[model samples]
Target: MTVSDQTLSTAGTEVADGIVLTDVAASKVRSLLEQEGRTDLQLRVAVQPGGCSGLRYQLFFDERALDGDIVKKFGGVGVVVDRMSAPYLTGAVIDFTDTIEKQGFTIDNPNAQNSCACGDSFH
Candidate 1:
């Protein structure tokens, strides 16, 4: 498989096919990495079945790169996606918000035709 180093932009956020980590998101990820003190960790993003809307997302720090993993680097942070979950996560944007009302990483997935009420699961 070919990995493109080219960068795509959405709302000023850099992107790739499977996933895009925004500037704020990347910064947060880097900060978290520093806190964890683990250089081997990479952010893993995956799409899994069995949510109310038929699909759910899993995002976390992973130390192992499984077989068939698609790895990309964004602003010094490594993001990994497995082959199976790649298609469903294409054109997805990950952003971090620090608003007073809500503070966390938010995902904007164009592939999701429908999503559950809680915004955790999508089509």
Candidate 2:
């Protein structure tokens, strides 16, 4: 696969398959990594089977460089997506939202036709 040609004027939200990491989310990820006192780990995003929808997302810190990984950087934080998940996550935006209702990382996936109630899974 190739990196998407589309890009936003705001900042470094551009990446392979059009997956974007917003500035706020990048800062949060940097803070979380700093708290752990390690720079070796990179944020890894993957799609796995399960959840109410056909696919579920998995986000975690990882150091291994899996084959065919799509790598990108946002505010010094590294984000990795596996080859298989890249297509599903194309044009997706990863953001951090904090409000009275909720606070945490969020994925805005354009590819998903519909998502479950919790919003943890999509198809």
Candidate 3:
């Protein structure tokens, strides 16, 4: 409901329950939103069954606020995590990295016991 100022860099900002968004990640999100010129979308993070390990992380922009959706904000960026995916994402940190080796958003989840080598799935 409340929107504040910008970015969390290396450290992260905690969401409604336990998920986190690093400042750089937030800035990237905000940048994306600005590029799209849409204010109704929120970054939705969810876990779905599939992938090599078992469950896979899903991240995307969403406008629908489903029932049981958990919402939180980091600066002007809003984030939503469904009730079912909440537990799996506990203590999870979402960050953006742009090194010569790799570039993109990454999730660091403490709840994952085992993740596939390709990094797309987890158990």
TM-score per candidate, chains pooled: 0.89, 0.88, 0.89
Clashing pairs in 3: 8-23, 9-23
For residues 35-61, write the lDDT of model 2, one tens digit per residue.
999899989989999889989989999
Candidate 3 versus the native: TM-score? 0.89
After best superposition, candidate 3 residue 21: deviation in angstroms?
0.5
Q: Candidate 1 on 1-123: residue-level lDDT in tens?
A: 334457666675677765779989989999999999998898999999977999999989998868888888787788889999999888798999999899998989999999999888999
- Poorest 10 consecutive residues by lDDT, candidate 1: 1-10
- Compose the digit string of candidate 3's lDDT tens values, residues 22-95: 77888999999999999999999999999999999999999988888887787668988888999999989899
Query: What do the candidate models score in CA lDDT, each in turn?
Result: 0.86, 0.83, 0.85
Considering only N, C-alpha and C atoms within 3 Å, which residue pairs clash in candidate 1? Answer: none
Q: Give the per-residue Cα lDDT of candidate 3 at 100.
A: 100
Candidate RMSDs in order: 2.0, 3.2, 3.3
Root-mean-square deviation of Cα positions for candidate 3 versus the true structure, in angstroms: 3.3
Q: Rank by lDDT, descending?
A: 1, 3, 2
- The residue ranges of model 2 lying beyond 4 angstroms of the native Cα positions read 1-16
